[model samples]
Structure formats: C-alpha cells, structure tokens
Target: MPQNIYVDSYTLESLSNDQNVCNACRHLYIKWKNENSELSSILDHFKNDMYELMNVQVQTEDSPRLTTEENPTLITTTNHQVVKLQLNAASSFHTKCCVCVENLRDHAAKITSQNRDFIFFSRNIWIPEGARCCSGHLINQLLLKEAVDQIKPFSIRYQELSSSDVQLLLNKAQNFVENGKKIFSFDDPRDLNDDEYRLLTRVSRDNFNDFVQTSSTIRPSCSRSIRTAVGIYLCKLRLGFGYVTHQYVIGRHTTAIARELMCGGDSTDTTIIIIDRTHLHIQKSRNNKFERKTFNLCKKRSLLKSMMIITTIGYVVACIGSFMFNFNNNDAGITKDILLRNTSNILSWLKEHDILAVDRGFRDSICVMEALGLEATIPSFLDGRRQFSAEEANESRCITKIRWVVEVANRCLKQFKYFANTIQNSSLVYLESDVNCLRSHQSLSTTYDKI
Candidate 1:
C-alpha cells in the first residue's frame, strides 16, 4: 500500500459488499501484542483515550474508532494517522456502512443493555444526501451535506449524544429552512397624500392656450371651413344635446351641423407637431356592410380612424390629417397616403428635421415621414420571439419615457361621452369636438404644468 492509502487489504478488496474491516485490525493488533507485550500495553491505553475523544465528538454508539490506537506508535505518528483516518472515514460513504460480513446481530450484546442498539439497526439503508455507511464506526454528521436527502440508521441513542449535540444533528437533517425574521410590506408607511399623484397625472389648462396655439395643425377645411365646422361639432358633442338644441345654442342650421366635418382647407405655418389617433364609430351606411375590425388592446370598436396633429405645448389641434376607413387591410391601410398633404407646414420643415413624438401604432408612419425627410420618436418594441439586446432594450425604455404624454392626450379625448363612444356619423363631424377638447379642458387647469 502507498503512504497515502490507509485502509487495510481486507477492507479495500471487500467490494464494499457485506464488508467487515475491524476484525482484521484486531487480528493485526493481537499479532503485535503477542510479539511485544510492552508495546501492546501502551497501545491498549491509547485505544481507550481515542474512544473517549470520539465519544465526546460523535453521536453514534459503536466507536469502531475504538481500536485506531491499536498501532504500536500511539504516542507519535500513530495518533495522527488514526485521527486523519477518522476524518476521512467520516466524510466518505464508509461512515454510514452498517453491513456485516457475518452476524453482528449477536454482537449487539457487547455494549451495555441501556446502549444495547446495534450500529446497523436497519441494514441496506439508502442514503440520497450523504454517506450510506453500515455504521459500526464513529460517524461525523458535520461532514455530511445539508442539501441532499439522506437516510439514517437508528443506532443514534447508543452514542450518548446530549440535547445540544442532537440539535446539531437535526439541524443538519433540516437542510436549512428560513427563520422569517424580516417583514415585507407593499405600501410605504410614511406616504402622506395622493394629491400630488393626481396632479402629476393630468396637464393643467393655464398654459392650455400656448400649448394649443403652438401645437395645432393647419386648419383642415370643408364646405364650412375647418374652424367653423369644428366649433359647431364640439358644441353638440360636449353637451350630448341634439343638433337642434346645439344649433339654437350656436345659431346654426341642424341640417348643416352633421357628424362628419370635412377639411377642404390648406395647411399653414405650424411647428412642433404631436400627432395622435382615435377610433370613431359610425353607423354602417349602405346596408351596414362596413366590416369593422376589433381592437381589444386599446379597448375601442371602430370603422374609422382619425389622425390628429397637435402642438407640443397645448390643446391647439393643427390638423385632422386623415380619416382612414380601411383598417388592418392591404393598400397602405390607414396611413397609406402620407400626412403631409393634410398637414399645413413649411415643406422645409421636413428638411429642418422636425421630430414628432408618437405612439407604437404610428411606427409605420415613421417610415412615411422619413421618406419625406422627417424624424419621429416612438417607444421601443419589446415583444418578439427572442429578447431584445441590451442596446435595443435601453433604447425602448428611453422612448417610452418620452411617449407617455401622447397616451395621456388620448385619454383626455376619451373623457368626452360623444368622442369616447362609437360615432354614428359617416363624415368628419366629430373632428371639431375632439380638437376643441384641449380648450374646453381649460376649466381643468390648476397650474401650467398640470400635465
């Protein structure tokens, strides 16, 4: 055997099957004792001391470690070798071996009746977590893992382990459950009031005029011109009053006050455009054959699409650029035709590289604008087969940070009962009410930064 190899030949070649190693050690010890009585006497004394040390450390009954001191050099290299063997044996699978080559069932009488249990009280014990030793030797539970599930034989009470030592054993078996010493809460305990939160969600109307004038598109016109038609339409939608009642209120004919307000006018001087879209439900004319697509994501039912452009600052709606009826279909769908024709601006504004803050739905519109030399800023796309790369995800987050205001603007339009519902009108009638919602919201302002 090499210097590092400690186990005797009988133990190693046993195939770990019904193994019995201690008999050979005793036989070797007896051989030495017969050869030299003085050395045997000293070794016998040392053996007793080793058993006492193991008894203090381990919880098991049979300290096969009892005979580690059988070596003649118990005072020098022998003691160290025994201790090293004990530690190594404790950590390895042999620590739990309770199998006997013969019958140790009868040997159970060797220990006192109070400590009568044999090391292998139950043979063939399965160990999923730690060693599956047959258990005739001193075992080390400290060396066992805390994670794997393991089986233990009932030789436990034999070692004379105290309550504290038992606790250590049980703790190793427990695999470490959380003690739950810390507390968790959903809301902040020190939070004062929701007033600030409410104010932050809405924009104020004090600076409403500036926002509108700066943001409004070139007045789209019609038979009544864009402004005249829009004003009359708003009066009707705002109150939900009949066209007759609204006509009396605004001095207009009920016949002329139709739902669709056409924009036959021209685009004018305008900058800083914030464009948004809304669904307008219309009574299906011509046998009601208009196949309206459903959009559950935005929670709106519509046969028509209304794209409105506003200034960055206020409620001024510059243009109701397109009233697209074809949705989710081929042939450019809603944004098929470019918006520049409906919008009034310096053609040079496109060359000036004006940037428009838009929503994800208008993502297609960005390419249209880019073709005409304009820039658009929109949120990033997070949904796809693979995850977004770091740079793409960061850019998407940045875009959403700036795009929330457009969402707020859409919510403001939805507040109106008329604009909020599906419209029965086939024309651009509701355009005025939707555009004027900015000015009407003046009553809703507290500070200029109410948004």
Candidate 2:
C-alpha cells in the first residue's frame, strides 16, 4: 500500500525544502494520521469478534439439545444429555450380557423383542442389538423380576441420528405405551389374567367385571374412569379389614365341639353365640365431657368399644355399638341394652335354652338373659377369693375356650391397618356401612378359601 497526499503548490514547496510545514497543513496531516490508526484498530477488533462468533455457532450445531420436536426421546436431566436407543430385536449373536456386562456363559439367551420392550418401557434402559443375558435372568423368555431391576444404564454414548431415526423412535415409544406393560390395569380386558385379578382385588375376573357393570352409575373423574373407581374401591376394601357376617356366627349343630358344649338335657341343635368387646383407640376429643367419656381406665387412652358377636368357628356375626368407652358402655350394660332394645332382633331370634357364651364381664346380663329364657353362660368370677375354685376353673375353661374365637375374630379385623389405626371422628359416619361391607367380604372370602 502507498500513501498519497495532495497539496497546494505552497505546501508542496514547503515540504520539498524540508522547512516546517504551515500550521494549517501540519494540523490537517496530524488529524488524518490519527483517524487512520483508529480505523485499523477497529478493523482488527472486528476480525477477532467475527472469528469468535463463528466458533460459537459451530459448537452449538454439534451439541445435542432437548427439543421435543427434534429429540423426542432424549432425556436431559442433568449436565449430560441422554439419548434413548432401541435394542436390536433380530440379533442372535452376543458375546456378553447387556445387563451385567459380564462374559457370555452357557445358556445365554438372545433378548426377545418383548423383553426389550419390558426393559425399555419399565426400566427406561435400552439394550443394544445382538445382546444376550444369562438364562437365569429370564423366565419363559421374559426378563426375570430381579434381572429387570438390575438392568440399568451404566454408560452414555453420543448418537448421530437422522430424521428417520427420530421418527422411528417416536413411533416405537407410542406403540410400547399403547400395547406394552401395564400394572394391575383393569380397563383393558386382557391386561390382567383372571388369577391376577383375584389375587390383587380378592374377586374373580368375571365377578369383578360384573361388579363394575353394576356400579356403572359411579361418576367418572378426569383422572379415572368408573371402572377404575370401582376397582380402586374393591382393592382398598381387600387391603383393609374384611368384615364378618351375622348367620355364620350362629353355632352350627353339626360340629363335634358344639355337641360337647351342650348340657346333658339340652337339645343337640342349640343356637350358641359368643360375645366380646374389642377396643379401638381414638384421638382425644376437644370437648372435656367427650374426652372423659371416651377415656379407657384399663388402656389409659381415649377409646371406643365395639361389641363383637361371633361363632365357635371364628366367624363374626355382627359388630355393634362402637360406643364410647364410658361408665355406661361396659360389656354388661351394652348387652343388657341390646336385649332391652332388641337390637338386631335378638328377642325374636332367641328361643328358650339358646346359649350365649360370654366372658365374666357379661355377669350382669345373666339375669336379663334368664328372664328372656336365654342362657347367658358367663365365666365364673373368683369374687373376693385369691383364685378360682376347681369347679369354677373348669367351668370358666369351657366358656373361655369358646370365647377365644371372638378374640381371634377381632384379631383378624385388626390385622387390617385401617381398623388397627386410631379412628378419626370424621370417619364415624361411614363406620357402620363400611363394617357391614367388610363383613360380607370376610364371610365370602373365608367360604371361598375353605372350598
């Protein structure tokens, strides 16, 4: 490059003579030189900026991004982006197991398409094609439960995918969700087998379907269908306490033990019912009177009492009262009140000489039962004696042996966490209906199990 400065004759003459240029020309040259230096610096800076912008653009293009439209199956939870891959369904050659990454042993089975779907859909793990696993990890060609748990992604790889590959992945994911694994799904008829339905909900598949149909009036919510609501109810009932029924609690004459309990002159076919009271702890009420009424002296807690009537065979006949554990709600008082009120048609159901086996707590009910021509067989109390006499002990043993069934029946109900836990006051409104429903389930389930 060459620099050219045009000047008038006078300026040129002054320059040729090497004399100081005129002040006006000198100032003009200095200004021009400063402007050139600034322009050159600006150009260099612009070149460097352009280089940096180009480098950034290249890096951005190479990095994987989490765009729903571009990478539907890409999962970027942290710093590293995860690309989901599908296992090769048709590959029959594998030198090592995909799960454990161990050397291939004898009986290494090729991963089936179903197994791959199960792993990918459930475990969110992609098994590579031509992969095999030990036969022990499979059950009937499906991944064993333990093996499925062990299948986890250990390493990541950068995958270069085309548009077609991304489309294929989206299609595969949609298909797996629509037709693959489901856990206890009741909406689809084929999702679960009959036995599975029975095991989970304690109802046969046909019965469950029928129940769903019967409950069609159940309103569906946005989150669940009517069938799902019914299924959840049944499952909750099965999970909670199953109740006992009335007729099953009445003693059957066919049993040998029932005959043994009968007196010499008493008829062999006598109706015997075992009765007891079970305690359910409750939260202390805010009201002083209410809290005081519910406080139990024996347990030293606020409690409610339910009268359990059962049979010698350990079947619950009815659960009643669930009354406050007050002075007026003792076993004897509750029994007397039930008879006086003829609750559950006790007076109608009882005949002369019909036996009621109860613990000593029912001593006050003996006269009431006698007046009604019913025999209230209560365990003998020692009174002021240090111990029971031999005769009283023997008599008490007989009553206790039969009374223990009611205890066992109560235990069964309490086995469910719902009843075992303290009852909230708000739940009392539904307690009776819930108890009745439970009784029906318990009776039916027991009958079925016996068969």
Q: Name the best candidate (by TM-score).
A: 2
Write model 1 residue lDDT over 1-451, tens digit each, in one string: 1100112222332112123446566665455346434323323433444444433333222345544355334333322323211100112233323222233432221222111111111122222223333333211121111111132333222123332332332232222111211221111111112332122223232232233344356465455433334334433343211111311321221111111111111212212345666555555454434444422334344445555543333333332433545446322344435355533332423333445656677776677777766667666776764677887676556545433454556667677676666566554465644554443342211322454
Which pairs, if any, clash in model 2?
Answer: 243-438, 243-439, 244-439
Task: Score candidate 2 by TM-score against the native.
Answer: 0.51
Q: Which candidate is the best by lDDT?
A: 2
lDDT of 1: 0.37
Model 2, 1-451: lDDT tens digits are 0011212221322122123455676675455445445223322423343333333333444556734466544322222422233332222237767767678887888888767756655655666556788887754466655577776675554343332343344345445655653444667554566667775677887788778777857888799987678776775664211322223233342234554764544455466777788887787779899899999888988988877765666555566767778888899999999889987666665667778888778888889989988887877766788998898788877777556656667777786677889878888767655554334333322432353
Residue runs of model 1 more than 4 Å from their true location after superposition: 1-272, 284-286, 289-301, 311-316, 319-322, 328-336, 340-342, 345-351, 382-385, 426-451
* Local accuracy by lDDT, each model: 0.37, 0.61
The RMSD (Cα, Å) of candidate 2 is 23.8
Worst 10 residues of 2 by lDDT: 1-10
